[model samples]
Target: MALYNKRINDQLMTNCLALSNELLEKETHSFFPNIMSYWNHILFGDLILLRRLALNHIAGLTPQTLSALPTPKSPQDIYCRKLSDFAHLRSQVDELIIQYCTNLTDENCEQFISYTTTEGESITKVIADLTQHIFNHQAHHRGQLTCVLSQFGVNYGCMDLPIIVSEGSRANA
Candidate 1:
């Protein structure tokens, strides 16, 4: 999971840094107004999930306190962060996520997390499932990002995990 997250983050950072600030801010004809908004949304979601995981008392996954986690003022506030700022924050959150997942045990993954939604709804779900959801969510938005980039004629290259692994192995060899 840590390796998978690292691969995803590496791709995202590479793609984002390749764009100019003006291009990052350009409005995309999609659900998200622009690349920046989509990028920020990904970071915002990760922070929220990490905070929830931290609150679940999962040993190494738990931070000192909930307040220590990054919290957006609101969901919309995420869309307002500058692209560069979001990129920096995303790097930090991605690193923390990799560390948390690396230290997670099977017992910890089997535990359940209980939390209230922003809409005031209560829910309980297995930590392992939630962890997978986090990655799935990132992949969904990354698809959107790639589409948006393509609309602008920006080619991000192969995002497939197998291809990434093969290329990485060749580089190492």
Candidate 2:
């Protein structure tokens, strides 16, 4: 799931990079306001959630390791104002997620995660569920991104997981 999400993110990043800065930051008058805004929100949310999960230090994912990652003050925080800058951080976060998942064990997944929400509400959830939520959250916002990108005539190609894996399998055969 993490690997497939990474591929989709890569595709989206590529499409975003192809746009001029003006268009990337153009006012969409949508909920996110612009392409960069959508990208920023995704990254911010990922970092925030991952940080909570990393608190367990599961699979050697120590909070100290992610200490360098920018801590967003809120969901709407824009850590990387430019798309290029966001791309760099996005790449790092994607790699971290892949590494984290690659080492996850069934035992780890069953563990409980207790973390405070962005709204300051305390919450407890199973690690497996949180992991699923991470990917799901990515897909949810990525869909919004594609919708807005479509308005600009950008085609992101097929995002279906099975299709991506099948295409990769065929290439490697």
Maximum-lDDT candidate? 2
Q: Which candidate ranks first by TM-score, i.e. highest?
A: 2
Give the runs in model 2 whose Cα sits over 4 Å from its true position: 167-173
Return the TM-score for each candidate structure.
Answer: 0.85, 0.92
Give the C-alpha miss distance for residue 141 in model 2, angstroms: 0.3
lDDT of 1 by residue, 1-173 (tens): 55666677777677778788888888898979988888777777777777788877674666574455467545555533556665666766777877787778899889998988767789999999888888888888889988998889987777777666553455555
Clashes of 1: 0
Instruction: Predict model 1's lDDT versus the native.
Output: 0.75
Which stretches of candidate 1 lie above 4 Å from their native place? Answer: 65-69, 166-173
Error of 1 at 8 (Å): 2.7
Query: Counting only residues 3 or more apart in sequence or on different chains, how many pairs clash (N, Cα, C under 3 Å) in candidate 2?
Result: 0
Give the distance in Å from residue 2's predicted Cα in candidate 1 to where it truly belongs.
2.9
Q: lDDT scores for all predictions?
A: 0.75, 0.86
Error of 2 at 136 (Å): 0.6
